[model samples]
Target chain A: MKIIKNLALGVSFIMSTQLVSAASTGTTLETVSPEADRIALQNFYKKRFPNTELQDYVNGIYAVDADSRTQWEDIEAFPPYEFDVEEGERLFNIAFANGKGYADCFENGGIGIRQNFPYWNKEEGTVKTLEQEINECRESNGEKALKWGKGPIAQISAYMAWTSRGKVFDISIPDGDKKALAAYLDGKKFFYSKRGQLNLSCANCHVQGSNIRIRADLASPALGHTSHFPVFRSKWGELGTLHRRYKGCHQDSRSNPLDMQSETFRNLEFFQTYMSNGLVVNGPGSRK
Target chain B: MRKLTTSMCVTGLVALLATSPASALTVEESIAEGKAVYMGKSRGNCISCHQINDPDANLPGNQGPPMFAMAQRFPDKRILRAQVWDATKNNPISIMPPLGKHWILSEEDIDAVVEYIYQF
Candidate 1:
């Protein structure tokens, strides 16, 4: 009788533990209903961060009001917006070393370009960001690519961001596309990967429990950052593209910034932007 | 009759000149002076990080905020002046050097630049 009681208790404990773990990891669309999927995500975040606040959207984008929140009015007056767009336009029209202009590369004349960014490429088995696509176009055309985070490419990107002002971020992860799933998973891995001199991951500054300080300013969450690209930086005296801001963050972390149009950066952008899918685009924003 | 017309024309010119305030410079003159200051020739050389010019100029930098639509953003001249003079006091991480604290400009120079920015 005693042995049977002990065995029953052990089995019950094991079952409860398994249930908790499954709840935290969430389920793929194939395995769970939409409502269940949302519950799973909520459970996962709640389990991982018991104290942090959580918000959800249908588009998968999440805005985590970071520590320091700057009003839109305050940012609108930043000085960088003064010249970034003009400079960007100049670079866009200029011929690259291979004699191709930025306008010649895109499908829609780059008008709705931001909408399709951070896409999954099945052929390459990877994610491609706007920056990577731009650089790749330059390389394929036999032109010397601009150094990442520097020069004409960055300027053009800033211009693209400026043009995308007020547009809604519309990215979707289609069902049953294994490549897209893998790409998103890769993005998630990148988000949690810790690197740089500070040993920080993207999650460190964006997620709860990580305290970010710049002099005295509070750090806003990374969730909504993608929606406010081509930001006018008061320090830069012009508008800056998303990748340019990424480079800045990299530099701040004491890590060498990737090229402005590099594959890694594109993947990061894809992940970052997808995370901000539902937020309204507000480009040419000002930042400190 | 011709003499009378000439006199009327002169009177009109004088009235036009007299009606305009001496302190209120035209937008073109203010932008020109601001450009000079931005290029580092005037009392305040703001070009170190700021790229100030129309799109035709093509010079770009990433160190300071753009100057477009300043009037719409900060309608109050006093708030704008305080921000220019001491941004760090408002937001500590602000990289902008305090022009007022550094004595980079006399009070008159600061006032002129502030006025010019307001006009923008």
Candidate 2:
């Protein structure tokens, strides 16, 4: 591990030197590999919390703080999202006026398929998320679209997530596709770019300042951050989708929050979910 | 008529800008106000990532370096103020907010913060 760390550092140092020369000549910088980025990010958290297992990161803050873990475990004993899941199943099976349903829109009837989401759509030239697809499914089937963040959409998402428990995240950006790569790179840039009056980025809190407190709240590590979604937050007292959380985080930084399921956000989901490529599905989880 | 009025207003604004500092808070008052801003959760909240180095300080974080010997570390007060204004100018990856640059903290408040921290 130490040798790998040294090697990574050496490689980065060489790349940075090259980058400086490239900048001086007004040449474009080299494109980064998504796989390499994921490996490096996972290694970072592993080094940061030496005792933590990579898989344990799906638990978020609970993976580091024992007190929080205990509280989270007690809450998880009978998950708050149980009702939402049941409602989602009901909504999923119900036929639209056209006699088509969500199952008809997705492969394998949409069961246990949450792990394959935020995928690169070659024909559409866009990144597709399960939430966006759900709405698309509805609109195509002659039904009105559900709200993006909460309510029925969240419930259905929670149900799908519940079905996909333990399935590893397997997001993929199509090979040799420049547009897909561009989307991935854009998301990566946004993840690290500072914004808002606070002048903070997603990396600042989750990357550099994990486990640190901002007033009363502890910052969580970014690893496996996407594994859990459609979370039942005690603060909100209801279930909300991943985009909803992104919106809130942006607002907290005093940056203007992007619209739900927008291209920018869908691309961000692509980059973030790809980072947790090997983490198990553990969505519809509870959080404080 | 409009040009004369505009010039008069510009001159008046310049006079006010020049005299404002003289009429601002005194050294002791500035220091006190600076301390409040530094500690205020909605303001600087420097303690979120920095330790004040005071024994009585509460719940200081270890992300940034300890905040002792400010005068030694930053002999020139403007340099220190510039940091609080925007630390990223020195270190691009710095997590410190651009308080003045982003208008999160007014110039007057930043000056007060500089005065408060300079004592240590």
Candidate 3:
């Protein structure tokens, strides 16, 4: 057993030397195989624990005791990827007693729904976000209403975010429609607008001051803020939709938080999502 | 001349009394105590936003600046102390609440936080 241990140590030393030489010479080392890597790791642990299994060695090296990352993954897969989609599909298909389903409300059976959402609605003369669409669907159907921030309707929005995960965000108010264009402009203004008791705008932390160390890590940009949604917040211990997050932000800003499906929130989403055009949606982000 | 000599004698006695063995708190001890106050539940709760030098602490918020880099930014202890006392006074738009004015921290606690931050 002593001889075997000595042989392993000698082999590991030779392997490390070769790795260093290869790295310096910009050449690959044939001796540095996966088996060698495993053996080297095994030797390292042998010094700590004389008789631990390979599985145990790997597990000890790469162990993450917390479920924060997993929870975020689950949140990103919510709605379409989880049971929430089935509920949304049910709501989408169920016809009201007045013989109307969401299909009757929208011209496209909600197809291309993701494209035009967070868009300035020329007919309504206001911006409409996905959350508002859900509420509107409920109200038009004469169904019992779900409170904007609280219930299954928000979950359905999460489902929409999941379904639209890979779809590029494309929201444009036509130039010819000046009224709608003005609404879009208002959204843009809001993005840069400084409010709250702090007198800080979203731009302060996310745009001009990004990468500034806040406690431990740098702040991220607001450019792609809307790309992640239906995110699982560890603080909340549950998956939350984009509007729910908006409510949290408002509270953080010390502003009167808007209703979950309010027009202001929808417009804000529209503006925020428009800024995130072309970015791949990585929903269900984890944050400290 | 006698009165002048008596005054000098009294001054010498006062100086001797003032020089009696005095023990002052070290900066490190003050910092450690301040860190405890910051992390304590009823006090600053600063761990919610600010990351400390301690490596074991997890999940520090990105809402505020990290305490580790503060020494590099503000070299003067007095300036740093004032900043911690009331950030909004420096930048009117700052979201950070004033620890001193708001009664979020006691004077000793603030001094300790200042000492800790200065060491960082």
Residue B34, model 3: lDDT of: 72
**Candidate number with the higher lDDT (1 or 2):** 2
Q: Could you give the candidate ranking by TM-score, starting with the highest?
A: 2, 3, 1
What is the lDDT of every predicted structure here? 0.55, 0.81, 0.55
Worst 10 residues of 2 chain A by lDDT: A18-27
Which of the two, 1 or 2, has more TM-score?
A: 2
Error of 1 at A62 (Å): 15
On a 0 to 1 TM-score scale, where does candidate 1 land against the true structure? Answer: 0.51
Residue A169 local lDDT, model 1: 68
- How well is each residue in A78-173 modelled by candidate 2, as lDDT tens digits? 999889999999989999999989999998999999999989999999999999999999999888999899999999999999999999998987
lDDT for each residue of candidate 3 in B1-120, tens digit (9 for 90 to 100): 656655654554465446521225576677678778777656766776666677645666545666665645653344566666766564544546567866668677888877765555
Residue A61 lDDT, candidate 2, scale 0-100: 91
Clashing pairs in 2: none
Docking class of 3: incorrect
Reference-based TM-score, model 2: 0.83
Name the weakest run of 10 consecutive residues (lDDT summed) in model 3 chain A: A57-66
Judged by lDDT, which candidate is best?
Answer: 2
For every candidate in turn, the CA RMSD to the true structure comes to 24.5, 9.5, 17.8
Comparing chain B with the reference, what is the TM-score for each candidate?
0.60, 0.78, 0.71
Q: What does DockQ give for each predicted structure?
A: 0.01, 0.16, 0.10
- Give fnat of each prediction, in order: 0.00, 0.27, 0.17
